[model samples]
Target: MKTILVIEDDIGIQKQLKWSLSEFELVFAQDRQSALTQLRRYEPDVVTLDLGLPPDEANATEGLACLNDILNFNPNCKVIVITGNTDNSHALKAIALGAYDYYQKPIDADVLNVTLNRAFKLAQLEAENRALRSSNVAAQEIIGNSDAMIKACRTVEKIAPTEITTLLLGESGTGKEVFARAIHKQSPRVKKPFVAINCASIPENLLESELFGYERGAFTGANKTTLGKIECANGGTLLLDEIGDMPLSLQAKMLRFLQERVIERIGGRQEIEVDVRVICATHRNLSEMVAEQSFREDLYYRISEITLVIPPLRDRGHDIIVIAKALLHRFNDEFNSKIQGFSDCAMQAMMQHSWPGNIRELQNKLKSAVILADSKQISAEDLGLTAQSSKTATLRMVREQAESQAIRHAHSLASGNLSKTADILGVTRPTLYALIEKYKLLDLRTTESETQQ
Candidate 1:
């Protein structure tokens, strides 16, 4: 059973509340000292505080102290403060001090019950969200520090605040969906739901209704009113994955919604207003599509207001190795493998091979390797990559490969901190600086600062 602590100085009111709140595992304290003691003992999920306690029965000071103490102990706990009927100022102050809400004196039982119910519901949701976050997959997390990746991160941080339509352009396997989510998570609507739909996955006949929704009896299969993905993502984000494949007919309706912020569900007479951020991702060349009339010229302009190009895995230089190791650690936990790390030959082979499918391919291969490898260290054979037959020991190729591997590993171990990168490479801070100078790593590092109009 969930616990509640009631802190009030009035004996008569306490008895009345105790009877009313008998459904809860309730504990009471008549003063600040006793309240603190009870808080430690019960660690209750909710607290009902009357901001008029001993020594300041007419003031909010004593009650405010208890409120602060409760928050200090458990920031997740919901504290509801009771205040004078006409005084909204003290209630607002309690809110600023982290109280969940305030109830006026001479409290109506119905109103207070509603407020308590809402607070409890909020507490439960917060707990569930925390648990879910802790258990989420690491591959789902962004794990690259290459210049291309950093630039992508910076772009997301900037564009997430605006209502502009965003288009993420990338190769087939580069992580456009991940970047889209990062934008949503950083945006003002982060607290709301984020719904993702792949345009290429749905059949042409069903895509329209899937997005704009349908009315009851609208079609042969429609038995009930349904909210579409757009409506479901109200006040949040909607990721249109493989948006290049969105049917031409639906593109017109999508463009209407983008231009007007309203949608008329299929067979529905009234238009529905929705506030949603649209993030579109595709591997296709949309400009080329516009030239060919395959995609609407107007829709292309709208979605490309802020376009981000995610570099392919081979082009991202050292990021491939950084991403590979991250995938390895994730699979290790999931497959219950005793794999400690990658062997020298495995690392060499990973650096040599070109990643055709980018991060997605790397993750899949690592997941497979972790389950199949028999030894502690993963080797080249385990990764399913073999060294080339015409192996050249040219100094240029060897140094270039070593330098690329060093940059990737340093960034990974340092979590993208440049100063840490210098330290980990075992070169003097200035020597490491000169190496970054002698090599063209600066372009990779500085590319993150670029912004789109």
Candidate 2:
């Protein structure tokens, strides 16, 4: 049972309160000092305080002090102040001091009971909401700042309202499932279930049964009546991941269900109506599969009412940096590491390299780098990227390399004509003279008459 602490100086009032609040384990205190002691001892969920307490029953100073102390000890604790009917100003002051509520004497039992119950229910609801918010943050863990990702968010916003079937087309590891969940979260059916089934993961023989379920004694292992994924996702969404891998025969049945909004269990003669919004995803080119006569054309049309193309990570500008920071936070929590962040060289290397497997490849590399990194920050070598060697190894060596290459290339291409070389390179005559001065290519810079054919 919830505990309640009462701080009232009157012995008669304490007796009445204790008897009235019999539903809870009530603790009584006659003064501010005793009330604070009981508060810490019991850690009660609620408290009732009478402003008339010892040391000065005429003033509400002691009660107000106790209320502040109780709240400081446990911010979630609810405290109700009992004041005289005429002392409306003091009641308002008590409220501003963070009392949960106020009661004016003579207190009505029914009114106080309603107030207490409301406080308890509010606390319970707040706890539940906090838990739900934490779960939402956990589910939305994927992060990126690319233009493609921004467009994807917009597409989600547009299609989440209507009851249209969506097809997510992307390469493997390009986060098709993440986008699918995002769609479901934004849809009208967010409160309902979102069932995801991979067509390619299950064997061909069992795929139909998995999608459509089976009746009792339908097969050797079918001991009881079972509902299919479509039925399970009624009033919500069903994600058919890798739909391109579904068998040709089952594809026809899936199309029938999409059209008719009904399904039949395996070895059952009854047609059960189902309400489900279908969302499909596949990495393969469905058009080619249709041309090859492997996939049904009718099914493709049913699933692709709205198509979303997710660009691979390589094409998304500056997304590498955004993704790196998110992955760092994730790995830090996962491995219990105190690593600060990525090094400058590491960021440059990530920008330079091509992420062939897209986001999945980046995730794997960061995981390894986090585990193997000796210093607080991850460096380019930790990520196994080779530093560019052609740049400045030294200043004089760089100048010599630059001059020798420029002179030889210009001499070879121009064949001893300075004006022709400058014209061919699209450089101004004076700029060409600067190069000739710097590289000491004066021999190549013969007179203009010598340059003429």
Candidate 3:
């Protein structure tokens, strides 16, 4: 139960408050001196202060001083000042001095209880946000110590404080968004919104409206005007994920907007100017797409004034174990499990296997392992690593899987346009055709006729 301190000089009033607020652990104080003592002792989340105190029932000087002292000691503690019915001036002054809310001479128990509950909830939310924020600060940069990883970190740290348009290149699940967040957190615009939109996630038809919002009555369901992601992130950072997947038609419009720094809603004619730091990320190679004319060369250059390529997880030798240990401890707390660490066999499996799915795959695997682990330590079996999986994946197998998945992802991003898919994969028409046939990636085909092209 949360503690509440009541500072009322009247004996009858104190009895009445204690009886009414039976839900909380109530501490009574009749004077400023006693209230301060209780405050220092209990460190209560809330306090109800009566402006009328002992030795000066005619004035609010003592009560006001006590309120100031309470606030001075703990800025986060929520304090409610009780005032006379006609003393609106004192109540307003109390608020100006950081009092949470004020109650008048006639305090209704139910009304006061509502305010107290709200204050407690607000305090709890603020505390959680602070905790989460601190963890975010600790995880501000990518966690890796390898040379390639260090190079990526240095590039991000070097470019974060600037307004330069940057492109993050890497395979899927390699933490491009994490790197983007690190950049935004370190940028001048850190105080502003860090809006992110996945181009590949949203439908091709609605993607335009989502990027640049629609006006009221623009569509059948457009009941109210809406601000797009770009406008919402004004004076902040905007991340366009899977930009290579952005449809061919939308690419031209996006290019125009980037060039002008202004956007017009789907049905709105007026161009709304935006001041956002645009960051683009994709597992697909844009330069190859540019060569094949699927992605506009101009747009690629505009977004990639600087580029940072995150190394694949398999290549970051020792960093895998480092990240895995940190994840184990975090998951331990989250699952309320006492998993000591990885078993020797589990560690061997982790180090040997090619992390095809990268960090995302690793995180999911660990999450399941933590949940399923019966012993203090997690075994390779806990991670679902079979005998075959524990064996090191061959270089050929790794290359084939990576290449096939990359092609399939590009096809999905391009919406099964073979021309665009070939462009995104940086392969000629013949090579892309051969890879698709070789991998049986026809599941990505939109229509059978298109595959023939």
TM for candidate 2 is 0.57
Off by over 4 Å in 2: 1-142, 387-453
lDDT of 3: 0.83
> Clashes in model 2: which pairs?
none
User: What would the per-residue lDDT of candidate 3 be over residues 248-285, giving only the tens digit for each residue?
Assistant: 98988998888899999877989889999999999998
Over 27-83, each residue of candidate 1 has an lDDT whose tens digit, in order, gives 899889999999999988889999988889888889888888888889789999987
Q: Order the candidate numbers by TM-score, best to worst.
A: 2, 1, 3
Comparing 2 with 3 on TM-score, the higher-scoring candidate is 2
Model 1 pairs whose backbones collide: none
Better of 2 and 3 by lDDT: 3
lDDT of 2: 0.81
The lDDT per prediction is 0.80, 0.81, 0.83
Clashes of each: 0, 0, 0
Candidate 2 per-residue C-alpha lDDT over 182-247 given as tens digits, one digit per residue, 9 for 90 to 100: 888878899999999999999999999889999999999899999889899999999999999999
Task: Score residue 84 of candidate 1 by CA lDDT.
Answer: 67
Q: Once superposed on the true structure, which residue ranges of model 3 sit more than 4 Å away at CA?
A: 1-139, 386-453
